[model samples]
Each structure stands twice: as structure tokens, then as C-alpha cells.
Target: MDVVAWQFLLLVNPNDEDAALQQFAAFRAALEEAGGDADPAALLRDVIDWKAGFHVGEDDAAGLMDALDELASRWRQRIDWGLDDDADAVPDTDAVLQTAFVQLRERHYSLWTAETGEATLSGWITHERDEEAMQLVAGALGLSARPGIG
Candidate 1:
């Protein structure tokens, strides 16, 4: 529905573990208490059944992006595989370094669209992350970071 602001969360477990059910239960309870008009609890129920890492928030884009950027940076560092130690190890800067940034940017936009009701929240809440939709969101946000990537 039309949410004034949104908080998007991405939770991950390297092993693809299953802790989302409990967390979602608690989150739904909180949403109920907050009087989520669109019945976010129901929306979340549909979302968490498949996408364990996805979570919503209440009108907090800046905070969300900051968190995403931090998460992206950490993910990039981990995935870079020690390339940071030496220039020689750098792997196709344009192709490799931008992957995480792109992913993060996409996530930011997807959440925004869903939150703003520009796109249907249930439609956006899919089992998989929609990279294309994310790209659109990032573009709108003018998301930029180091080396002209967002």
C-alpha cells in the first residue's frame, strides 16, 4: 500500500539457514501493534515464506541505504578475495567491483517501489530478488558511490 516511508532489510546466512520464520512471526506481531494499515503482517507472511532475508521498515530510506552500503562494502570485501592487498590482484574492475554495488542499488530501489506503492508490494515481494527492478530504483535515487557505481 501507500507507506510514507519504508525500511528494507536484507538478512543472509552463508549456509542458507532457516531462522526467518521465528523472526517474521515476531515482526508481524510488531506490525500489528503499530497498526500497519495495509496489513504488512500478511504481506510479510507471503514474503518470508520464500525469501528468508527480506524485511520491511517504516519510512527510513537514508538509514536503509546506509545500512545497505555498509553491507555491500562488507560483502565486496569478503568476495574480493584479497584483491585489496595488491593492485595486481585486481580482477576486471568494471565487471567485478561493481557487482555488489549494483546488487545493493537494486535492493534499495525494489524496497522503495514497494514502500511507495509505485509497484504492488505483493508483486515486488517475490521469492527471488528482482535485479532489474532494483536497477530502476537505484537510477531514480541517483545512487552513487566510489568510482561512479551505485
Candidate 2:
């Protein structure tokens, strides 16, 4: 079997928990609405059951954790820039650019492939404060903090 690996990160603002949850609800509703003949719940369950197979070495696990931390730090920096600046004025350009990159990364996940192997890691990162707003906050934060992108 050919090997493949994928990684995804999602992020949300610490202050937008309600909006995130609402978006998630809307997504679910849209899915249900589109399921003309099939059961929405069953469809969701089946999708969740489809897991990509792969393996992570100890070093890879450690690296993943480090990447997550970096992402979170970058998100926090951007948020701080927004909070410390005038509301009517634009925030720091560097922060804004970083945040934008974070958004893009969260929207796209990476894929890796190798012979006889495949792996997919999909998730998000955000501030602890944004947990209630979005489930993928963590993923978003991490992606933003990544070097060269966020």
C-alpha cells in the first residue's frame, strides 16, 4: 500500500466563540439539509469512522507539540496587537499579515505520501479563551505560528 500523510490546522479568535459555534451549527444544518435520502447522523458517523492509517515516531510527536506551541504564540501576539491598539485604527501591519496567513493555513491542510504508508492530522489551534467559540481554535493558532506562513 502506498503511504500518505496529511496535516491540517484551524484557528479562531479568542473573542469569537459564539460565532464559531454558530458556524459549526450552520455547517451541520447544511449537511442535514443536503441529505435528501440518506440519514445525516449516519452519514456523519460513517465519515468520522474513516481514519487514515499512519505512524508517528517519538521525535515526530515532539516536533508536532513544538509546532503547536509556536502557532499559539503567534496567535497571541496578533491578538495582543489588536487589543493594545486603537479600535478605530488599523492594527499593526505585521500582525495583520501574520493573522491573514494563519487564516489561510487553517483553511488548508498538508498532505504527505510515502510507499506503504499514509497519515493525516487534521485539527486547529486558538487561544484557550476561544474554545467555546470554535472547536478548531487550537489548529488555527498553530498554523498561524508556523514559520514562513504565519
Candidate 3:
């Protein structure tokens, strides 16, 4: 039997409401240009509802996931991985993990809001399996194939 993967919830920071709408428009245009039969207005509605913690239907969910995955893939490709000698060096794994945590926290604050304003994109992923999901995310992010981490 094939293992199922839990869908990953990707939270993107669009910077503001205008940017989010623009991004959604671009996605809609691309889908239309590709002859996709999905309704752009409905898709946008689902995305808006998604931000409010509502469950989108399977087809719409899949479409949103695909759009996010494509965006992430493009962004990942643009990353420049290089180590600078002048950069600060961490002394140990614990320090590195701490630093990572701090960064993640900072990012969360920067990308999320508590008021009625749009500055970020957030969604959830659900699946019966965890390992498969991790693998998929690793592959999507262009990381080496290492098990047990997402």
C-alpha cells in the first residue's frame, strides 16, 4: 500500500492586501491562459475564506495548494546559498537551533496580524501520513533527501 502524505500548510507574506489581490489575479490569469476550467472568482473567495479558517472544497483546496507550491518552487530557485567568511559563526548546534527559532519567531510576527488587515497568507495542510508530507516539502524546498524532517 502507498503511504499518504499530509498536505503542508504554507503561510506566505504578501506584504499587504493589495499585493495579495494582485498575486491572486496573476494566478487566476495564468490558470485561465492555461485553459483551466476553475472559476477565478470562486477560487478567490475560497482563498479569502481560507484566511478565516474555513475549509475549502477538495478541488479548490487542490488548486490553492498547487498555486502555493508553484510560488514556493519559484522562490526556492531564486535563493542564493553561499557562506561568507566574514559572517558570524555559530559555536554549536544548540546555538544554531536557537538562532533558527528566533528567526522563525521573528518571521511569524512579521508575516501575521491580529487585527483586520491583510499582510500575510496562511493555510493548513491535512493528510493521514506525516513522513510522506515531510518528504514532499523537502523536495519542494530543494533540500537534500533526508528523512524525518519537514
Candidate 4:
């Protein structure tokens, strides 16, 4: 499926057109890399950090926190992980992530997780204003994703 530039723009660059355009170029190149038939799921990793996104092992709570913190810092914000960012202090990776997701929502940022079929969680963050349209964006790119919590 060929996703339009505008749609890609919305998904990666909801607030900055210039940045979105830059990413769109990279996204297009990524699509072209597979002879114009690349799997969107696979292409996600390449495009993730172009703006902000993460893919980490399920049990790597510290890594997740670090990735999230880096993304948040890009926006001049921080996540209230509800505790110190020590992996041991965190009871469950799920709970720590759930809390971060909630905190992100309150800041107009949406954190989404996708099923990876592995012992890992992968997803991206978008502005809250774009939250409602994220699933559609995912569909257009042929990705199955949802907001998950535990």
C-alpha cells in the first residue's frame, strides 16, 4: 500500500512541517529500499528515532526509561515514572510503563505499544492532538498497533 506524503507527515511530524518533510524523505527512501514493497512494520525501526520512538526488550525497564527520557527531553519534558529509574525498584515493567503512559497523556503526548511477537515492546509517541488518528495512520502503513497497559 502506498501511503501519501501528507499522511506520513501527520504521523511523524504533527507539529513541525519541516521536520516531517525531512522524515518523509527518509520514509520514502526506506520504502524504496525494498523495491517499493517494504514491510511497514520493518520500516518502523528506521523511522522511529528520526523523530521519537522506541523498541526495547520486555524486561529492560531501565532501557525503556532511558529511551522514554531521551524522547521526553527532546520535547523539553520529563516522565514521572512514579519512582526512581532503577530497574530493581520497579516492581513490574508493565506497571512502570503504564504509569509513564498515563503521565505522558497528561502532557498531551501519547505512548503506543505494538505487538512484536517477541519478548519485547515496540512503539512510538505522538502528540495528544494526533492520538485519535494514530491507529488510522498505522493502518495506512500496514501496522497493527494499540495503546497497551498493565
Candidate 5:
């Protein structure tokens, strides 16, 4: 894989090289679909699945929760969002995310959010120790990343 592809692969699918290659292909296709002008970060936002990270829509609170839970499950962790999962009323997105961030930090995992210029919550979680490493990867991708809290 090329350097960019390789870096993206590592970010989205470090444990499975084959899966990373496939996700990279999807990202390339997404980029082309955007008339070659989509923010790279946006295209990459929802690319990774539960196996790695998550890219979810802004209004999709359930989706966000599911993605977060799935990602956290990798480390045998979970978060209590302090609400019913089946409730029709969605809690504040930022609040819920901030809650998740705090909960994850206790477990030594960092949840990240990126500036994708879209109506979406896009990010992934990595070990706290990987915060610097995540910055380097985001820099390579030419995107800005930050911890996902309120």
C-alpha cells in the first residue's frame, strides 16, 4: 500500500491489514464521490467499523451509542449513558459524548473527534498512550483531531 493508504490502514484497522485495505478502498471511492473535494477527514469519518472506530451521523444518537459501545467492547469496557437505550427522546449529543469520553478515559482509552465539516460526529478511540501517535496520524492525513468531549 502507498504511504497514505498504509497510515489510514493502521488507523482504522491496525489488527487486520486486509480489512484496512478494504476500508482504504472505500475511502478512495468516497473521495471520488465527493467530486474530489470532500474533506479527507469527512470521507474517513464513518469508514471504520466497530472493530476499530466509528463515524456516525449527528442526529443518529443511537448509532453513536452503538458505535461507541462496539468500539469499547474491544477492550471489554462499557459506558452507562444514564438513559434508556430505547428512549425516543435523545439526550444532548455533546453531553452523551462527553460522558463517554470521561468513562473511557477512566479505562485509559481516548475517544477522538475530528473536524469533518459535516453534520456528523466522527472519531475513533485509542489508548491514552496513543494520543500523540493519533496526532501524528491525523497530521499525515492533513486533518485536525481532538479529544471528544462536550
Candidate 6:
């Protein structure tokens, strides 16, 4: 996709409707000089929401499992610390994460909540996902099932 100077300016400052044409030209010039074939998608790979959480830091299976175990433990604690008077009412959190497993897929799956938003996939998931996996992730993340992102 060829990005024009005006398009570059719009991306840089969407609110600045009054951005000068000369400034945009200069910006595009610099961008072209730096590299015209720069992949925008690759540059913004980390902009996804599912990439949140503690990095495995290592590329080995043991390291990935350790991270997943730690994440599961922390989430379980938040779901039910066992100190509540009605602890029985709080169902086992393990059932929700039963399907959680480390797999070498095109993308890494993740689940987290607003309060305990400290979980992440050990590796980066940078490809498309099926509907079933998306639903599983949504449920695990405690996201609303109200259809769209309204």
C-alpha cells in the first residue's frame, strides 16, 4: 500500500486538521529516505490487546509452563482466596482454565481481567484465529458476551 504525504500526516496527527502541507511533505520525504518498504503491520505487531502479561523470557518449554502455572495460580487466588465466608459459593477456577495449554500455533492465546490484567501468552500470536478459539479466549478473559465492542 502506497502511503501519500497527506495520509502520513493524518496518521501522525488526526486531530491536527490544520497541519501544513510543507510539514507533511517533509515527513513523507524523511519516511521515504529512511525506507520505502517498511512493513507497517510488522512495525505495529505489539499493538494487540492479547499480548498483555508476564513474558516467558525464555524460548524453552519449561520456561513457558512455569509462566503459565504462575499466571493460573495468581488468577485462581483472585477468583477465590479461600478466606471468604461463602467460599463454597465460589466455584473452582481451574475448570475455566482446563483448556489452557501451551501450543506452538501461529498466534498465542491469552486471558485476563480488568483488575488482574497481568497475564499474557508466553510467545507472540501474530496471525488469524478461529471462532472457537476466539470465544474461548473471550470467556477465559472474562470479557462480555454482548456481541460487538460497543
- Which prediction has more favorable TM-score, 4 or 6? 4
Tens-digit lDDT track of model 4 for 1-150: 445445745565556777767666776688888775677666655576535677788998878878878877766778887665454575467876787788888888877777767788777777777766887877666666776551
Query: Which candidate has the highest TM-score of all?
Result: 4
lDDT of 6: 0.32
Per-residue C-alpha lDDT of model 3 across residues 16-129, encoded as one tens digit per residue: 445455545555565567465654323433443434222222234334333333333332322111226575542332232233224333333111111112322233222223
Residue-wise C-alpha lDDT for candidate 6, range 1-150, written one tens digit per residue? 224323432332334445425444444455566596653322221222122222432223334434445544433312223236654442223322222322212123333212222232222221123334434543443432211111
How does candidate 1 score on lDDT?
A: 0.34
Worst 10 residues of 5 by lDDT: 1-10
Per-candidate TM equals 0.29, 0.24, 0.27, 0.79, 0.76, 0.22
Name the better of 4 and 6 by lDDT: 4
- Candidate 1 lDDT over 34-143, as tens digits, reads 67354553444344432432222333333333333443443342222333444554334233324434444454422222232322121122113545443443334332
State the TM-score for model 2.
0.24
Off by over 4 Å in 4: 1-6, 84-91
Per-residue lDDT for 32-125 in model 2, tens only?
Answer: 6766664432322222221211223223533333334344444443222334334554434334435534543454422221111224232234
Whole-model Cα lDDT per candidate?
A: 0.34, 0.32, 0.32, 0.70, 0.74, 0.32
Q: Which stretches of candidate 5 lie over 4 Å from their true place?
A: 28-39, 49-51, 84-89
- Candidate 3: list runs displaced more than 4 Å: 1-11, 37-102, 106-149
The root-mean-square deviation over C-alpha atoms between each candidate and the true structure, in angstroms, is 11.5, 15.5, 15.8, 2.8, 3.1, 14.7
Q: Per the 3 Å backbone cut-off, how many clashing residue pairs does candidate 5 have?
A: 0
